[model samples]
Target: MASNHHRLSGAPVAAAVDSAAVRITGLTRSFGNRQVLDDINLTIARGEFTALLGRSGSGKSTLLRAVAGLDHGTVGSGEILVPERVSLVFQDSRLLPWLKILDNVVLGLPGKDARGRGRAALDEVSLAKRESAWPHELSGGEQQRAALARSLVSEPELLLADEPFGSLDALTRIRMHRLLRRLYETHRPAVLLVTHDVDEAVILADRVLVLDDGDFVQDLRIDLPAERDPGDPGFQHYRTTLLGALGVLPAHRTKEQS
Candidate 1:
């Protein structure tokens, strides 16, 4: 895949020591009189896994689109500075049905090395044998795996995910979480995952942020061990905190407890 066309100055620069992967200041997005994102400011450090949570229409996806440069026409004020190379994964696999899975993975990639890299990415997702298969032939989980491989094949500096696994079944989602964690360990791309599931956010992200009323309501660090259990006190505390920020009572935790 080609590098993202959206850079602050359209010029490459070296990443400063411990520099942030994404930085937004005074960012705003409006549609007529309705402002979806209001002067949001955030910084995501290199290689950090951050999860964004919010109620519907709270501007989570809007913010991500702005960061991805897909909403440039709607973006107003502020600035979004991202690394030169970037990639995005969406809720849907979004693969072309007519293209073979391998061809889809190598879509925009150039040069003789493209095929090699694409196959390697597929192998990483445990789909090496399915490269010749069609998109319609794969299960939801498999399609998602292919989507992930396609995004990672480019080796981006930052990876933006908009609820990448939200469409999967419960068991498949769990497996994808593990797969994502392993992939992050190996690739170390700065990631921003926009998700609705508070538990999923807490389980997968190094930091969890809640966006509400067009601004950040909560920014909490996960400080738990990598191997986490949802039943653990620390994990539950973070989950409760995020769920509360969204103004919803946790189904597993009572109102008073939350």
Candidate 2:
């Protein structure tokens, strides 16, 4: 596969007015004869939080990797426009066991105040006191928190997360959800979170997208209040709509009803 991805910049004045944090046009990715993405076009506004949901092999991670410029084998005719500063968080924390928590956060970070910024990032994730601890010393959730700090230490303009909380238990996932929301608000970075959990998407995203068969099938804006509760009627409404788009009936809804 040959890469067709390029950096986007130098837009005209009118286009600059509507500039996006991440813009992908006519993007497609294929492995062998199977296409993962099919001429998909997407634009995420500055500081907008967008969640992507899809079943396995639906190309969620492929799209994210394309934007992050990590898809070396990507072959398609498309243009991806993203800020120079981009950070990615995966399902695993990916921390170096040999490095201390603070060092892990600041790894590869440049500048004289890198250490100070690393400390501040750790503080934001509530891991300030664990700066000297090793990755193995922290719990599963704490390690993920450190990973988040590492992503934010550079103050990226766009943050891409691929199931960053998938490994945690139910309670830890909820806590991480709240923490991610707070960080998003404080940092105001354009975020694209790839998740399988519909509830998580509805809780954290300003807009939700459903991808199926290598194309985006639904684009729904989340209009719920910031303080969302799963039991709220509005929350349930969005959740149901998204679930329906993914071709899954709600647990309470039966095939006979449909």
Candidate 3:
């Protein structure tokens, strides 16, 4: 993991957008008659930051793969269509060892202007200076940023993120949150983020959906303002509400802090 796109660490996203970027109807998946995802009906709107919340085995990641066309269905029914493009940013950076940081970002792109696009993506994350650097040389944050650069350089129409910041420390995670929010506003892609962090979902998503036992348990539109701060009372209220939606036992708290 350390040798590859993981430099230490890391969308055309849009401002004004239209309808749902990816729509799923009766989306179900099974493993030898054991259902993993059961009747998932959801719509992810364009230019919207949406989050999928669930426990480890709730099939959140599996749903993401299905959307990405990375996995085939066994007994489900659904379609993922994109006029532009679709891409996924996994939990790990997944960089190539032989490729330089910039080259890795340009992996999917043409070699000509790949570096340029790579640089721009890095600039968005404030890691442009590390352009020529090796993946193994960067800090965890930088590596993640580089990985993001690679993902965004493709200018995807639909962006799927699977707990991209799950491994970061509190401070780093918050920083990544702010970075993502800014990039989302700038690049403006339709985002479907799958995260275990309730606070993260509240902070980053325009709408939050909870998956329980392979099906959606709660789907809520966040009425909180975009400029919401974790320290603010209104934000806290909304965060608490999201926690409740996640079926928090009132005893064990969501690991994600505001």
Candidate 4:
């Protein structure tokens, strides 16, 4: 990891004074004549959990790419200052087929302690025994758990997830949610999750933001306690509000209206 630190030396300095893990101002991205993202400005504070909700082709992924610094040549203009240490998890595990689970976690990690740290991270996610297993051998949820270990092994200051649980079954997604919350409590990394699931956002995030036509349309704060009950009137209100922002109406709300 000592050598890895040198590679991260060039990353933009995070604005710790303002408690911002990520800060973007007047950001824009275009593909030829088509503007995919337009003049977007947002800030994510340290240790804050925020979720982004948007329709398909609404520039949610584009914005996430910009913040991850993966939009280097594609970005037309603007400043995206992200924390020096950032880790991203995608809907797919994206684990290498050839590498063992342990190796996958320590992929970019350097220094002598990398393996130890990798094992510890797997243990954190309750996958210590599967360290030697192949990616194809594990179940989908287990594969995602390994991916989580890989992301957290780096102990990043900011974590960016792009619909990570979208591919899982409902029950598996629920389990992942609990695991994520536990990990957040332990590590406290600033998190920005890009998701289309209104219920998931309401259940997990401290703040939920809606993006429509390349711009932020709504910003809502979830003030409920750690143990949230979807049946709670407050949860229903948030769910209804967010669904409405996404141009959706929950089944219950529709039934009530009828």
Model 4 TM-score, 2 decimals: 0.89
lDDT of 1 by residue, 1-258 (tens): 122223323333444433778878788777789888788889888899999999988988888888887764453666677877789999999999999999999999988999999999999999999999999999999999999999999888899999999889999999999999889989999999999999999889999888988899788888987767999988898878777778786544523231
Per-model tally of clashing residue pairs? 0, 0, 16, 2
Alpha carbon lDDT at 146, candidate 3: 81
Could you tell me which residue pairs clash in candidate 1? none
- The candidate, 1 or 3, that scores higher on lDDT is 1
* Model 3, span 36-83: residue lDDT tens: 888777777778889989887889888887777666324555444433
Clashes by residue pair, model 4: 1-110, 1-111
Task: Order candidates by lDDT, high to low.
Answer: 2, 1, 4, 3
> Each candidate's TM vs. the true structure?
0.90, 0.90, 0.85, 0.89
Q: What is the C-alpha lDDT of each candidate?
A: 0.85, 0.86, 0.75, 0.84
Candidate 2 on 150-218: residue-level lDDT in tens?
A: 999888888999999999999999999999999999999999999999999999998999999989988
Off by over 4 Å in 4: 1-17, 250-258
RMSD of 2: 5.1
Worst lDDT window (10 residues) for model 2?
A: 8-17
Best by TM-score: 2
Model 3 quality (TM-score):
0.85
